[model samples]
Target chain A: MDLATSGGEPERFGPTIGTLGEDALVSGVIDRYPSAPWLTVGPGDDAAVLDLTGSLAGPLIACTDTIVEGQDFLRHWSTARDIGIKVAAQNFADVAAMGGRPHTLLVSLTTPADVPAGWANSLADGLAAECSRAGAVVAGGDVSSGAEIAVTGTALGTLAVPRAVLRSGARPGDLIAVTPGSGRSAAGWALLRAGLRDVEDPVLAALVREHRAPVPPYPAGVEAALAGASAMIDTSDGLVRDALRVARASGAVLDLDPDALRPSADLLRAASVLGSAAGSEPEPDPRDWVLTGGEDHALLACFPPSAVVPAAFGVIGRVRSGEPGVWLGGRPFTGEGGWRHWS
Target chain B: MDLATSGGEPERFGPTIGTLGEDALVSGVIDRYPSAPWLTVGPGDDAAVLDLTGSLAGPLIACTDTIVEGQDFLRHWSTARDIGIKVAAQNFADVAAMGGRPHTLLVSLTTPADVPAGWANSLADGLAAECSRAGAVVAGGDVSSGAEIAVTGTALGTLAVPRAVLRSGARPGDLIAVTPGSGRSAAGWALLRAGLRDVEDPVLAALVREHRAPVPPYPAGVEAALAGASAMIDTSDGLVRDALRVARASGAVLDLDPDALRPSADLLRAASVLGSAAGSEPEPDPRDWVLTGGEDHALLACFPPSAVVPAAFGVIGRVRSGEPGVWLGGRPFTGEGGWRHWS
Candidate 1:
């Protein structure tokens, strides 16, 4: 929730957005993203111009995601900077899931008129930082007034390989793999929701931060694609639910190993701190977080039996011919809790 | 505000979005934009795949616009179908303003959980209809839960010529031209605001419809570019305000001719009907709507002295070497009303 660390020194609270007006606020936000060469024409024009001539091959991959105020994050729990970082990470992760590298982002931000101008600037800073980390630029965006804050990001990416890795391409007998760690975000969310935010354990605090701003492994996706990934997707809706998406799409059941779903030492330590903070209740199962915690933005991929899974990705399961669903330890696991916007 | 007439017969009211869940709602919206050959990997994938190889010539033009509930449109004033049409037209107009041919749109929609599922389907129908008219496709979209309806549309367009027509390209000697009609939308908005929806005159009702759904001249943009337009912009933020943007960007004064500013007979007739419906209050000035009304999405361009203006566009003004601002009848005109989201 600390926004000041991510960008320049936070300004003393300035004018309300209403006083500054849309044009001035827009100019301030646009100033945050400095001119880049790939952005042939930046924010001043009706539309931003992007030069994808030598950069793209085969086809362009596009995806969009909208994070709303009460649904996605509570303002009291998250700073504008955290919102910006999470929005960029989730949208860019979709491009990565498609075996493509994100090159441009178009952001549509809606906020109440009473929001401070400084908050908008800090949000832009966070977006710029994340886009910079992903090797992409903020091409253009639209800002409008609404009752609560909502950020909708559309990301465009280009594939280095000829074909994109799709969720429906996983064949039977393929190895299912995922980015090194998962479930930290869900554990963090549990801690925060349980009013353990001020817990003395640094590990627990780190987990909370992870929930606020996910760090998706951007490069590993391209490596997996190059390694002949049969199918891929971002773990935005938890490991099991997203895996079910691939299972249904590919008509293959994914059987995940129970041992593989056990929480890592760091996660277990964080869970213990949260457990102790809650007094008499039994310690929450870290395995549940690992299996069903969403918003990690971790890349989950499947590779053919003959293909070498990327070093950064840990093999967690295998695809097999069966009724289309996800299984754990040879049994159908249906403890449902993944991020669903409507429900 | 009637949504039923724009597309196929409206389906009976369905279950609320909360009962259907995110995936089902997404599937319903996706079904509206059927599979197209150019969409290599469509709605079900992590990202939509667009084959832009043979379709694009130069750089791609991208623009995003978000229309919120109260700020952009009121549900009682505009139906779901009208919201969809307005979103598409406003976004596509940005591409046209850049002298590019819009090819694809990615929509991000957020609505309350209790919204009827039928409303979403109708909204998608309106989006599809407009995109079809503009020679574009609805490649993909994201739907989420929020307190109010907000549609964020990102449009991608391809330039036929090597360079895009920027607002800064106009010279002092250029002629300012606009698409055949202007201020109809504003006049329509006035009529609606004054409770003249049930007016006896059909022309007045049509104006109300125009306020709900604007039909921007899409093809004229490319024609203007091909005919060597110096600069171009869509009149989304009123003629005077948008013209001031061009004037500031191009560093030239745009001087309007008073005769050209007169409202067409069609607009005047509608205004008179609305005035009569209001009972004894002074009639709103049609000229004021022509100058300050926004959301028309009409293309406004500047052409060089020798360049022939497109037949669809009417000459309205001339660019001159002076201060960076808009002028009406050889004098700086500054009347306050224009769309400002934050205000």
Candidate 2:
């Protein structure tokens, strides 16, 4: 349990977090990020004071999420750095979904005493890198001991426009569009579960990487908003589930065209290899993954029929006057395939 | 494992969290609080939008903290309601320390799948009650399944004045004062650890209750700010430890007078009972708890010597030019009795 050493060989061994105590552990995590001008009072205080006097034109948008061990992730499946990147991406996507730009993040981490100090350092690096990519800063955070590793992140953002693109704004004639690269994360998770480690196939390897670290379309949300999107949401739960959410919130029916959702080249290639690897089981459907896979973090928006859709977005469905539900190929699609924390 | 039952008998049994699913569990938790006008978009969306236009005169102050089971509290020692109240009080105190008025809270809970549904409901009720007590509202939160119960709270507040009271603002010849009641929480924790539970002594019982639920003077923070307090911090990490923080940050020496910290009546009574219950061991010093016991969340502030100390605050120490550290009775106090997360 005493995994302490002087050298920087984190892969082999490092000092356990308990040996260094709370103050040193905190300094190690915070030293990775540079100070920004917006932070009036940074991490080493009771609370962080932010100066947003003229930075925002409208109200502030806030969101919080927690990822727990054994429930949301497994250590053997992803590195500590990957966990950090994934959490930042998850929270930033919420701000993007509201057509706002993320400004600061407040992170709370709970870990076992025996965890290696290198794990926390790598996590801080990952968080700093991802926040830089999203144009935000890690303003403050708290660390404590716990039974397992659990991270809860809160993202704060500013709305530069007059109004935010809410989910309840879709109209009957709006065209439903989604960002490209849907179902890659789900396909990646499926490949990992199918015992495809260190995959020789390029497509399968890419899928696995997508599963480990998803690069959400952060800028596409603001672009869609400027392009006059009536409603907007991120595909964190699945294309079907998220679309249904907008439909129910707007009191309209979303009809998907089957031909529009043809599997991408990478998905098809991965599916072929997975089918060949499986001797007896049926081949997994790539189309089904595209329809129901979660954690893609793609932007899904409703644009007017007369409006020109952004080049980054593709039209996949249309809103119509009907009961609040999702329909595919003029038929109601009944499927229960989405992320559920308790189940 | 299936502890489900109808009627209002949460104490007896109830359905596990897994059986109800995520949406239902979230609904069960959120239905406890009433809606407020400041919450433009509440819990059901991707993020909670708050309209702060014309609500404050200065920038925002934000803070977050997490409480984990087995690390911060034990189930047998404190009820779920106590846990909820303690978390809220702790977060609110941080905002108050900055001389800010807390406006809203965002809570995230991670619990085991086998946890009873009633526990979540009661926790929500406790959080609502305490938030109401502090003149704040629960705008949003996230709930997920984990190995143990962990709560992370984010509190957002606004500085009504032009500037905030910072820890680095204390100068030489300033007066160090603290809100009334400091050692009761620590004394209560000691009594609990000493197996003095269910005591016939009313003073000891009140001490135990204080340990479970600390009522910080929230309004006094703003009063101190309006009265031109130069430096301020909350006593979350013992009086001596927090005093050292201000000293180090301000580059000055803080000297405490032993006579000024006279033991409260409840502390004296609790110490007497603990000593009698010690059997053959030496009696623990109540002064140690007063100096090194944390979690009291008492506001510690520095004001100019010429300024009138608020009637609610008690003067205990003074600032002077010397090496940066805490001094007691004109001598440097050397004690290693503060809470450490990973030790």
Candidate 3:
């Protein structure tokens, strides 16, 4: 239904959650989820059942992420569907980062009573759609009324490889590489913060959409692991900050190349638009977004020099023996980096 | 470490979440979680790994439940520890309702930045305590800043029996029974609402404690399933409303015996306190509380006439093949029953 753009639909303003009641509202959303072979029992029961009767090769991977209104996103900038998509993407990306295949998710939402039932339904639809895209299914969830809106998802995955990837596996002399996308979500956030919306330029509009909802490189994670990547993490908190995490965990120094980390052309153009909004000032450096912006959920991994780096990955740095830290162009780069909650 | 009564502890007023930062706050809580053999990977990684290496039993059971600050509880009434215990108990009860043994859980908490860090630590401790009680472990979770406090838990359980006892399996000749607890939580809520706190009466004070955190009979679920229960559900929404659900799902009529459904002595005493608070009403019928009170999380199951009901269960009703509804005292019982969200 393209709920992100269907702001003018009449039914979008239908009965409120209070008027519709919890059961009917839950039933409407649960019906939208497509059934899967692995789901032995669906949402109507006390608990959803997953058919894990056969012996598993490896361990089961699980991760959870949450998004709250006015904290992670602004209500006017991100629609209900955008919120749903972004929350699902972040959690699934975590499983993917572990060299696992996501199979199921349980999402819960707490909203105010005045919220329209259709908005909640759209959120579920968006969540379900993304699950299907990732070859996973929505197994079950809970809904309740609260003072503010908050959505959480716990994603479960099965490891395809015998051993799951760990961030502490990066060793000295390993090469650091990242999947194609990075910094677009940060650029989108900049545009939104600058009071720019409904931008006419396709590049600018796309950036705005990315800010609202990001498409993480889900498949690249498994591909990297198959290709023998040493350590892995999803770039939820910019390249430098997240890379610093791997470096600290592995007790090695990560030396990043400046030329290889240049901002994308779209980000450069976005900086231009944001710069003009403030009169008589030079363009804000797009490199900040490239090096420090987060939420792209790109797979940042360390690979052995002897292993075949996946085709989708771009080699951007190398691991060296030293005190654990991150360096740019052979020097320590001290710039404000990525998002942190309650900091 | 009894957080509910340890309000005067100096550490309880320690640094706020904003000052502590997300990583430190998360680490403090994660450190409290005891590791287990089944947990292949713990909380520090991008995802947790559960060692489901060999599986020959039934499917995996999953369920999620959420509790909000103002909707389900008030901050003044429920301490952070009480809130944590209640939330964990509710999710585990759902798993138990499916006749599964809970093994792991992922809890997510969203709260304002100004909250005391100790409050969050206490919450995690409480959750871990309850998980231990249920023979489970806290595998992973997420923490974020938000406008208000909301906690959600996704519990994972493994079935012990070959088949799950569903709510739709009741036959015409089945006997209805419930575990040895009900109406305590509702009675507790009434005491709290009447501005009664720290009562001299030990019995009344216990009811207040129950409202804050009611314990569910976790073992009885598996006991019912093992004893060949035909239909089962947790009484999260009063006895009659939940029994009605079982009846509607099984396409049968549930005839409840009111004589057997009498309120416990604690409830009768609580009603006397509430009736006195009104100053006029003659001890408002404790029978209403027995029939309509909710949140005790007692397991209600239908058994065959010959099935040896578990020793812990009290027989309260029978099933008959007629219109799908609930009857009491040989007539159609039509009194208002149970709790419903956003009604």
Candidate that would win on TM-score: 1
Which order, best to worst by DockQ? Answer: 1, 3, 2
Model 1 ranges off by over 4 Å: A1-12, A198-200, A278-282, B1-12, B198-200, B278-281
- Predict model 2's lDDT versus the native: 0.83
- Candidates sorted on TM-score, descending: 1, 3, 2
Q: Rate residue A118 of model 1 by lDDT.
A: 86
Quick one: best lDDT, which candidate?
1
- DockQ, every prediction: 0.85, 0.77, 0.80
For model 1, name the residue pairs that clash: none
lDDT of 2 by residue, A203-299 (tens): 7777877777778888888888888889999898899999888999899998888889899999988777778885625778999789999988888
If both were scored by DockQ, which would come out higher, candidate 2 or candidate 3? 3
Query: Which tens-of-lDDT digit does each residue in B289-325 have in candidate 1?
Result: 8988998888989999999998989999999999899
lDDT, candidate 3, A1-343, per-residue tens? 3343555433358899889988788889899899988888888778888985443335788998998888887777877777888888899999999998888989999888888898888788778878988888999999888878899999998887878888889988898999876888888888887777667899988988877878887898889889998999999989898998898888999999998999888988999878888652467788888888889889999999999999889999899989899999888878877889976
Query: Could you tell me the lDDT of residue A203 within candidate 2?
Result: 75
Q: What DockQ does candidate 2 have relative to the true complex? A: 0.77
Deviating ranges (above 4 Å) for candidate 2: A1-12, A195-197, A200-203, A278-282, B1-12, B194-202, B278-282
**What residue pairs are clashing in model 2?**
A3-A14, B3-B14
Weakest ten-residue segment in model 2 chain A by summed lDDT? A1-10
